[model samples]
Target: MNAVKIIAASPQEALEQVQAQVGPDAVILNVRKLPIDGMKKLWAKPQVEVLAAAPEQEPGEQESLRQLAVKVQQLEGELHARGVVPTETVPSPDAKLPPKVMQMIRAAQGDKLEEALLPAVQVLEQIGLLPSHARWLSAQSRNFLGATKPRNLPEEMELLREVLSEYWHQLARRLEKPGNPVRVLVGTPGSGKTTVLAKWATQETFLRQRPSRIWRLDADRPNTAEFLSLHGELLQVPVERVWDPDEQPPEDTLRLVDFPGVPADQP
Candidate 1:
């Protein structure tokens, strides 16, 4: 494989350049927004950098590309060590993060965390927590750091995890149980609301031996009623299509209501 980096005014432009140079079969490895420098920061738009690899070539070419990649990595490391490149590329988190989460952060924020809070943020990322959740936990950890004596990275991580787990446990206990007998599933089109309803109905009818019925709201979309009817057959329950608000099922049975999905632009 032959890999090359392309920088352009926008991601779309960069993609065009890659397609033109390496053809459609090229694999995109990474995309990042580059930082602007000096006077260019004032008026020039930030550029997007795309790293792409051509499909497998000859054996000699593959070996050459591998060597080139290693050399490039070494050069980048040297630049970072010499302070020629910005520190944003280097995440100073003491712990390693999961590859998936690391990729997500890199794509979203260029793998950058505030330097002072890198350790805490890294611990959160390692546990596969969302960025918002990590930020909140990081803030609480910072408070603890200030109130107590300094600790090692591992100790700090353990303390923060304990604190966060306690908070979630307390939250789960405080949440009120659902009082309403009727349950409704809602989401955008093809969001798996119907499938979820089917699974729930199956659990009730087969596992718990509780009687359940499905009520689907009629809308512009097609095949919803048919789909629910199929699930109804499997569950040995009746599936009803309701257009009017006043339509009701038997009072004794568990009812699963399926509301039509609305587009974001619709009123």
Candidate 2:
């Protein structure tokens, strides 16, 4: 309960009016002089403000909190290594940073952290680190190295693996089942394609449980075809200068081709 007493031009008149009205034990919280308003005006007088005291903290409770703070500080020091450890030790300030905070700071700081940590991040992620952990470490490392974190890692390694798996599965599905060898040897001139093919054929025959007969296409000319035939005889494989639809290639045989460049106007 609260009370306010207003002083008038005559204190005795005000006291008499209050005594005749409310009892005298009523506490007075404010006392102010009202400015005179003209008799012609019926407007209210301006009021002065008086505020209450705020609640104070208990001394015992405050002491307990201080003690708790000291204990927490001691525990924190014990849990973490001290003496200005390198930035590398800490979790990524950038990667683990809340996204909204990162965005705001990046807008202010600009490509500041990305330059240093992006390469490391890509390397680590490629080796199968969890996404969040990879990003956090990358971001942190970048900030530690005094650079802005990259916006994205080059994830081509993982993407490439996925694409290769898909491609192999599609190829196998197209074949429908295991069959004889199919080989494509393509390279610039003097790339050792012939030597590589021979080595691979040897591997297939001995290690892969599949013996192969190799064929070299010789559609160029009679002289070239004769030379290839001589070479094929040395390698113990068949050589042909033309296609034969009715003849089956040797079991599990790989056919190799060398193509000449197209003429300017040829379709």
Candidate 3:
């Protein structure tokens, strides 16, 4: 329920700032025309701006709006002094979790496992499972089987290991035949392309019998370069840099190219 103060030449300009920062749906809570001398001694005429609150009107929108509000509040004073306002929200801690998990956390229900949902989604997503599948996996993890006596530790560990092994084997089988690896693979932010690349490289190293060589065509980011470089060093694999596409790979070497998965804007 915080309010932001902004000074603009006109209400329209103030509304633009609100829309650009908080968006178009912001409710104009209050607006006032004020003398410039109140804060600054620079202008002869008065300035005006509309103050607005654009609370998220729907259950699904609350988290994002709350996050935006917090960020706007943090920068409000600085923005006022500098004559600018934030146009986007700071990233939220729960941003990577699925929307359903966010919704459940907002609900704050006794029956919901909101605390567990973030980690649950992360683990399942890392294991190459989709949201629908992960939802089922979370439910499975909650099984107590009526009243549970102290189970034999050894038997329980064995059962858990077997389940994990089968789960991964099924995941691995989903991959397209370890064919000639792609020239370049791209994915959006948070997509596990880099990890998948390392996993693929390690599999290739073991399967090829001969030492595997990695050639980096281009890294989408510094982090990607760091991960690949570290993995290559650990595996003692030779890595080459190819800045140009026309540059040829080493003779009889496996080449892996990583590209930034930039999504195309829709028309």
lDDT of 2 by residue, 163-250 (tens): 4466578898897746654465655444645545544553443346454555565323222223334334333455555556687766
Put the candidates in TM-score order, highest first.
1, 2, 3
lDDT of candidate 3 over 1-267, digit per residue (tens): 566667777655665576577654444445566755455666465666555565646645456556644544444444456664223222245457788886766567545333242232333344476655555454444452432332433333233334566668889789756545545567675576755665566556544644566665554444345556655654467666655568655555567765555554522
For model 3, give the 10-residue run with minimal summed lDDT: 85-94
lDDT of 1 by residue, 1-267 (tens): 668999988655776687689776555555567998899888999887777777565569557556655654555455456665222223435436777876776688764554444354554454476555666676676665434533644445455756677778889788746643677887787786776686677556655778887787766775444656754653468777754458655666888888777776687
Cα deviation at 90, candidate 2, in Å, is: 42
**Top lDDT prediction, candidate number:** 1
- Check candidate 3 and list the clashing pairs: none
Question: lDDT per model, in order?
Answer: 0.64, 0.45, 0.53
Tell me the TM-score of model 1: 0.39
Better of 1 and 3 by lDDT: 1
| TM-scores for the candidates | 0.39, 0.30, 0.29
The true-versus-predicted C-alpha distance at residue 246 of model 1, in Å, is: 4.2
